[model samples]
Target: MKKTVTALIGLSLLVSCGNKNQAPLFADVALADEKQTSDWLAYGRTHNERRYSPATDINTNNVADLKVDWFIELPNDVGLVSTPLVVNGVMYFTGTMNIIRAVDATNGSLIWEYDPKVVEEVKGKRKIGWAHSRGISFYEGRIFAATWDGRLIAIDAGTGAEIWSVRTYDMERSLYITGAPKAFKGKVLIGNGGTENGPTRGWVTAYEADTGEEAWKFYIVPGNPADGFENAAMEMAAETWTGDWWKHGGGGNAWHGFTYDAELDMLYIGTGNGSPWNQKIRSPGGGDNLFLSCIVALNPDTGEYVWHYQTTPGDTWDYTSNMDIILADLNIEGEERKAILHAPKNGFFYVIDRKTGKLISAEPYVETTWASHIDMKTGRPVEVEGSRYEDGPADITPSPWGAHNWQAMSYNPQTGLVYIPTHHLSTNFSDEGIDLENWQAREFTGGLGVRRKFSDKQPREYSASLQAWDPVKQEVAWYLPQETFWNAGTLTTAGNLVFQGRSDGKFLAYEASTGEILWEFDAGLGISAPPITYTINGRQYISLLVGFGGGFAGLGADAAELGWSYGIHSRRLISFSLEGSAEMAALPPPYFPEPLNDPNFTINDEMAARGAIVYTSCGVCHGSGLIAGGMAPDLRASALVLNKEAFSSIVRDGILAGRGMPGQPEITERELEDLRHYVRQRAMETSTSDRTGSTNNPRKEVESH
Candidate 1:
């Protein structure tokens, strides 16, 4: 097998030798085939989502010497969430604003940039509808990426120009792409992520690599007509769902991560939570919603459903199985078998046999109070009824973000350990008394719910934790606690190091073997993107984009509700390495508004209580009057009323495009006035404590380029 692989690599290198422009040396691991050199050829390395690299030049001992090599500043203040792909001495990545760039890996010089310009129809709505392009895919000299607003584009890897483009879905319906596309076997598979407050079904589609033609699509949730699949599989799927799930678009959105196992000829995809979130709405009858919230294994060539293991049956706690499904071989009951491993949002590390979807073992990787334990015999989660949010203000652990959120978690094959960046924090999640449809528009109504802060409720001993799990033993080996939260993904190196960016703005590297701190750099802002490593010339460089923004970065609905400084004016793409490196380039000035203290308004405790009642009407979408969800701004620290014009326009006209803040006619003028007053008071309270003095605004700070 090794000889065959070596021969293939050699043949590939010979073919590339004729190309004069190609770099003489590519990836750190020189194979017989040079075509595979230097570049991250597939998503998660080779589509199995292993995220493992053969490059060992920067391993354990030398990793400590890793320092700043060369850094390039993007001209725009676009959000940078892309996990860069390095191939043939060039780095390819995307930004939050949906621009793709190809840079010379050796010196951080711009090779080319492709701007998708996912511009909104208007500024306000743009802020609201803006979608992020996390990363892109490469196949046969072309790069593929799904746009924030529903377009699948293929670009020339060398030139960074659009080679062919196809619309993935309709943007008007609120479908967008925030995840990277996976290219395998001459086909491009992509998923749509926008299931926000809007009504949309999640689906995975494959297109012909060369022609840009969609070949086949598998809806994560069953469709209204249900025409595509074989009658047997479709019939089996239909049996699991009750009611007109077609109306609710059958809620399961597989927007996050997926992996393909070539050995098995199967593709494993993580399915998200059902729509309307409230189980009462999705499956009123309550049976295992077969495909929703599960790891589905399918045939890549035919899009045939092979088998599925439901992760969360009738998933009620907003627990979606749509976490990254990594494939690995593990021992179960003394027998080694190929298995699929996952650290789902429900806070459990699940191991299932890949040959046949059967549970091998399951255990909690983080502190979760939601379920008593996973019934290994039945592979079902035994939930404590009181732990669930049935309706009318219930405290649900893990919140909607899950115990381990969507930041990428890396599994190191060398150490046989899975490193996860997790949040030990918990929140009280409630289902506003309203039903599904009404919940969509008037979702934030305050009277519908309340939340008790659990962080302070627990002793200082309890907080966020980063854990390393031994999948073979089905147990946690070690854990490191953070003062706050670690929402970023984990990146493991062969050097026995694990790198992760924290919510508090520290980019840390820990000893992968013992969970001890090796080194940490203050990126000066919270990180939302994953860290990646590659060899440019002879040096191994580590790079990560740091900026404070994203749903986890305290973003609220509408620009006005978010704090400006935290908006990440310098969310620049930064690359670094060791000694005598390229001189650091000067950064552009930071953009911050002068701090201003608004005149205090005397609203007694009684008035605050009265305003709280009024807030019930506005909270329908803003989230229990606190503005918690990323879809909308947090009202507790809102600055809407700080600027009267901005406040009134949103209240009266509504900034539907940007913040998802809708204007309600049912709100009486008196109620609006009271709501405005309540917001002003909240702003004042936030200002006094924030110390930055700048009003919380969620939009990006324009760079003075």
Candidate 2:
């Protein structure tokens, strides 16, 4: 009963939706007012996410004549990691499948695009991965977003219409909603992500903000006390649980970083990992499983539970204190305090103490072998014991795609440091053999029972840096390296600069108090979100959201063996400043598509173990078994699986579901012929190990860690 799709075009947007949130416009004192200049509002633009940017008319000696200044392109080729949101001069954002647009931040134009057609709004449910929706939310004149099929919409920021939505959760109770909606005061917040491929559990609600109702949620984990218990914080998270840990749904899903501190009215959120992440089959006898990888502190008006800080305690390797927390104050010994900082994904870097969650330090920026540290007395994590593979397959180290995931770390209180953007990757975890009453979900949920295995699709060489730390001398004041590992996410300004973006399409801009670089721009495509700055009639620009596809589809086939593909371009939103100029439109000329092999497609081992449980949730957008986390298409050089009726008319008939390949009648036809015999038996074992020069049986890289 909650499907309010609307797309109006401006009658002053129905008089500002009958003046909701009592109009003074964008809430929470214009997002924690850093003397609010030329918008950028919330989502870390301020409220201390410290993405910095008090705007300085393109400083640092004219940032090398900045240039560009206008570009649009977006009709997505599946990747343009969002992060826009400027007010007054317009902006907003979010593309590839969580749709929502509304450009014109002073010269870009395009004012209204909405489409919560969120993949046909997932009407029939049962979906996984291809997740996108990493930005949106504005108060007063509306615009909330959050889709991926769990709803939360609201539209109307100057006429993209709608104005109310609410589905929030319960997609057949497997939960979804790729976070990105965090309004303030009048409420809004959201959170959820399939608990490691099935039988889930996780929470984060809080609706209202002018009538989408609800108003409170906060469940992190601890359910099924015979199906009742939404209070006493799930009765003290059901005493850190024991066996039958709610039979697989014990995952702590607070999906993606949420923040709001308008001066300690709190609401910090962050938690995820553990539904079959193999804590001995989901909490066999473990304890600290309470809030999976904690970081609580709620009470944004009634979702109570006011304090937590876990950070991977008994959470078996999918380590996720859901990244990004920021909120600073520092000064340390000379007194000022207040911190919070984070960096999660279990490769450490905490700093805590935001009014009593304690810990004031945690360390290890990366190169970990899983915990050789982090015991700030009782704050835990000195237990590196086979890193939860318990005496087995443990090649671990900052690699649950975490030595920080969900990139977005920038603090700079005038260079007091923080910058981040890490990546040295690692993974090898093991534990497959599950059956918890047949629990399930999808996409490499470590084939259920946590397997992992990623050191960036093997033939190794990962390393993406940007460091700078010093969160009050917790160290590292430098770093810039990179041979590539999904870049983009970090922007510091007030003119001493520090922008980012590279997966080999440059976009640089360094020197926020030493790291140098100065200026760059290649931007032919691949950029993974995060980069913002605003200013209109008074000048200054610097936008971003280039293109690279979400959570990097597990970097399969190393997205074109490392040029970070996404080829056949198109995914922009660009922008720059100082000498304006604008130009771009020049890509068209790279298209590799040639795999359609079959050297007689037969592949048995029970059809590659039923195509590894039908690609354990569709190899997260192709390439999690021959390793290619992203840039789709590369099934051993695809020729549409050597033409099985155009791969069964694009997976059982939706005919390339309008090009994004959508159509999977929840797959069955003997599970799509055992997922085309496990991707044509790993593309004929990667094309007969490259035509016989085989180096001892290779190929199998992608998914987890």
Candidate 3:
């Protein structure tokens, strides 16, 4: 039987205080201690962001005995991608619309629940973003979380009551928060993602943990000189940029990969790509855009720039350095040096000196065609001629989806290897028809200066693998090919094991050093979140959030074919232990939505053409080319599109906003009709003969990742 509480309850036992004799829960020293393995205090377990545990009770030898200990069903949640933070045996995680839940780590029992009510707060104005949060943070007695509507909130850990809340961005702008709030010292930090949706000048803010007061803010890109530089760092950054780059909101949003070095007393931020993604349009003079796609070290207290190492200088291929920044001590050239292990979207695995932001070694972990290699002396990628689509359309390896996206990679200090969830994909980038000189960014719409070419005739090749890379040797030690792309993040343990969940709903444990699968479990749902391990009562437990719906899963139609259609399977937070005997309920069989046919209704081709432009907003959740990728309901298969009133009530009336569907009050009635017609056209084109439709209808071409 399941044990759950719907209402928030005050539980004194959940706090770290025991008889008023113990140190406070999540103190600065406690969060920084790498030796503590009983609880996961931070996103990366520790400030180092290695995602490795020293606990060894569940070693590779006995990993096969692992079974489900407990699980909590999340029926209302969509994407279960947030990492659960364990504090003194109480697990806290953020779900859809930033709902925070506290559950018993020993047994899956709810302690308290906190809802931020993001939809009601946004008032249906914002339509995009708001899929899932990467995680939450813990400092002292507070749990910190960032909402989809760009608000950072703190809740009392004992009672789940809101302590303080602050908006991180302007409501009018196209900014949203999906990354976890990094808490360190007495402050919590957050950043927003909207580089493609608007003219966003990406930035990160640090706020006082106890109070909602802003402490320090760092803009990833330099703003206009007419407004004056914020500091000398912005002035120094301006020298490397040409043209009115600030007008495009020079995008270097640090959406993920934030690490704080307790030993070095410094902060490392993995910055993002240009606003429009086309440097030719954002930075016409072709100067290396300062801090875009870079590992920038800064003073955590002051938010002051220290040093940076640009991975993709003059980046135009959406190669953001927003991947995980793992801090470790490496013996390079027979000398001990602090290093940052990073595998970004560009397909290159970087090992840089964390102290000075200097490149130690860099190598291609995947098939990299944009750059031949990273220059050892200059630490810059050697770009191949025409790779940037300078002459025309060019097929590039390691597409914008990245060789390694925001998925967390774990580093095992015991094995001297970094376990990375790697993938291989390519995109054909072109600016063929866009007016280069007169291009302008549209509000809340994709501002990518370059267009990704899509064709039904072209065959797309893609694959994923779990790779064990040696930072010291700059090579892959072992690799296991996955069945599909966009696999979940990895977790490594000193127990000589690596745990990762797949999009196919299978969770596996492997020998950390040998790439041998020792155990597997069918989760019955796609998992996009990383698994975390912690111990309570001397029993080590492995836990994972099992649900799929992230960037790639939402956009790629092939991913939707895995049978994890929207709302078909239950989202869950599942845990396992060697002593676990609890059985998991079997999920419904894999479901593939059949396109609904409307014999009575006629599709307006003219309206469909206009609706295609408007579909861009809907495509943020619904798939591109009208194919739903399991994130939202596949409109082609929904009967609601057959009626104009039903479609408008859900799309423009905000009636279903409570169910993760945001209303677009801005969409006019004509646009709504056009959208309905467009979806019907796609349904007719993709419907099969047996489904009361034409057999000759060709499949819609989708954008290659």
Residues 124-224, candidate 2, lDDT per residue (tens digit)? 34455555667887887777988776888888787776878888765555566666878888998888787766667788889998889998787888887
| Clash tally for model 2 | 22
Please, what are the lDDT tens digits per residue for candidate 1 over residues 318-396? 6887778888876667888898889888888888999899998888876667787899888998987766566354555
Stretches > 4 Å off in candidate 1 = 1-37, 120-130, 224-231, 332-334, 389-394, 429-432, 435-462, 555-564, 567-569, 583-681, 689-705
Please give each candidate's TM-score.
0.80, 0.34, 0.96
What C-alpha lDDT values do all the predictions have? 0.62, 0.71, 0.84
TM-score of 3: 0.96
Best by TM-score: 3
- What CA RMSD would candidate 2 show? 23.5
Report the CA-based lDDT of candidate 1 relative to the real structure.
0.62
lDDT for 624 (candidate 2) = 62
